[model samples]
Target: MKKIIELKQVYKDYPLAGISQTVLHDINFEVVPGEFVAIVGPSGNGKSTLLNLLTGIDHPSSGQVIVNGAALQNLSNERLSLWRGANLGIVFQFFQLLPSLNLLQNVMLPMDFLGKLSKTQRRQQAMQLLERVGLADACHRLPSQVSGGQQQRAAIARALANDPPLIVADEPTGNLDAATADDVFDLFAHLRDQGKTLVMVTHNETLAAAASRKLEIRCGRIHADTPAVAG
Candidate 1:
């Protein structure tokens, strides 16, 4: 089967006071469809940078990032935005929901941006996604009105707005309590079971151990890539 996510000789660098500092060094990996991949590493060890590369938010200094059959590095910004909207969903740690828009509108925003569905259809699909994430009744509440977990659920719903094939999350449950974090993990597992490729950067060891595959990064290199012993 074809790879859903591939990074070839990936290296990421940033300029610090005129010198280049490398964050990811010669990274290479491939993720197939229907895989739940958890990336675990120490703080500031290039985990989030890797996710940014995969999601097209940041470009690799020199490498290829192919996701959902599209070479991300080859796409123009405009095309990349469109492609990302249709092919990938990102769940953020902070639950980056628009404060003014209620949960329903937040979930509908992606569909609106893509414009593949009518307003009515977007609403219907958004409602369904909200329900899928167990937030149907709270759909009308503002992000601030709900608990942190609820907001994260809304973020998940919004991420699924376009029915993207891949989901990339960066510290998605970092802000939630233990019980709530487990709930979010369960929801992600459900998505994985339904054939969505998931790659998550997490600090939670238990969650990492529960994933189908676990990758450990250290000092800008992948130290280990092994099948997770489910806990």
Candidate 2:
């Protein structure tokens, strides 16, 4: 399999009270194309920080973040932004849908920013994605009008709008009830089945077990990385 993402000797630090506090230490990992990997740990173990580094939303303090053979550290901010827009799909714990935009509009926003397709083409593609996520009937509804599950489905649709091969989801099902979380995870499994690479940070062990591989991050390092065992 082709390597889609690689991190070597990575480190991240933040300033606290005029002192540097390291958050991630010497992290090393690689994600192959079409792999579904779950990252789990207690809160503040640098899981979200790691995802931000992979997506190029934030740079590593040291070492490298290579995606698709290009060094993210070397890319200019504008170029990195463009690369992220084209290649990285991100889903957050909270559905980051625009309140002013309906479902269709929210899905179309990425295409608009990327400008890779015409307006009509973007709308058509967004509608298809919404349909795929089982939100076809909710396309015209505002995010507030939908249930939490429906809104999350819409967010997933939006994330897949560009047909990005790599998706980074941080606590995607965190806000939902058990039934809704199950449904959302089913959608994630469907995406994996379609050959998309998924790197998710999750607190739910059930959801983590659904992934092909699991990694435990603790104290800014990977304490374990292994395949999931069937129960």
Candidate 3:
């Protein structure tokens, strides 16, 4: 199978008061299908910047980011948004659920945006995803009505609504307590077992070590890329 993600000589620079600040330097990365990869680094060391590039939330200053067979640098913002809705599942550190929408509605939003399924089909699939995340009973509750863990679970359900091949999470369990974080991490492991390509940016070393591979960043560069010691 083709690589699920590829980045060649990627550099990301931002203008700060008329000076270009480089956040990523000559980053060459690739992820094969079904691999669970963790990116860990110090604060402000470009971990999240790399994730943004992978998700096409931001573009690199030079070089290429090809994910799921599409060169992100070549796509316009409008096209990138559509492609992301169909090909990538993203989980944020803070659950970005629509407070006005219930859990089920939040999960259905992606399918709604993609519009490849009917209303009935979307609802059914959303419920199935909520069930998978152990949140089916709470599907009718609004995000504010749920606990932090539950909100994150609903967010995961929303992420999977489109059944995208790749899932990119930025500190998915960062805000939860130890027990709750473990629960969320378990769900990610289950998804990995089911053959989703996952790239997670995390500060939890324990969780990072459990992934199939680990990439460490330092000083705007990849410091290490090694097979993790499976926990």
In the order shown, what is each candidate's alpha-carbon RMSD? 0.9, 1.0, 0.8
**Per-residue CA lDDT of candidate 3, range 156-211, in tens?**
98999999999999999999999999999899988888988999999988789879
lDDT: worst 10-residue window of model 1: 203-212
Leading candidate by lDDT? 3
Evaluated at residue 112, the lDDT of candidate 1 is 98
Q: Is candidate 2 or candidate 3 better by TM-score?
A: 3
Task: Give lDDT: candidate 1, residue 64.
Answer: 95
Which candidate number would show the highest TM-score if scored against the true structure? 3
In model 2, which regions exceed 4 Å deviation? Answer: none
Q: Write the per-residue lDDT of candidate 1 for residues 1-231, one digit (tens) a residue.
A: 889988999999999999999999999999999889999989999999999999999999998998888999899999999998999899999999999999999999999999999999999999999999899999899999999999999999999999898898999999999999999988987887788888999988777876899999999999999998976
Q: Each model's C-alpha lDDT?
A: 0.93, 0.92, 0.94
List runs of model 1 lying over 4 Å from the truth: none
Model 1 scores a C-alpha lDDT of: 0.93
Provide the clashing-pair count of each candidate structure: 0, 0, 0
- Model 2 TM-score, all chains together: 0.97
User: Could you tell me how far off, in angstroms, the CA of residue 143 lies in candidate 1 after the best superposition?
Assistant: 0.6
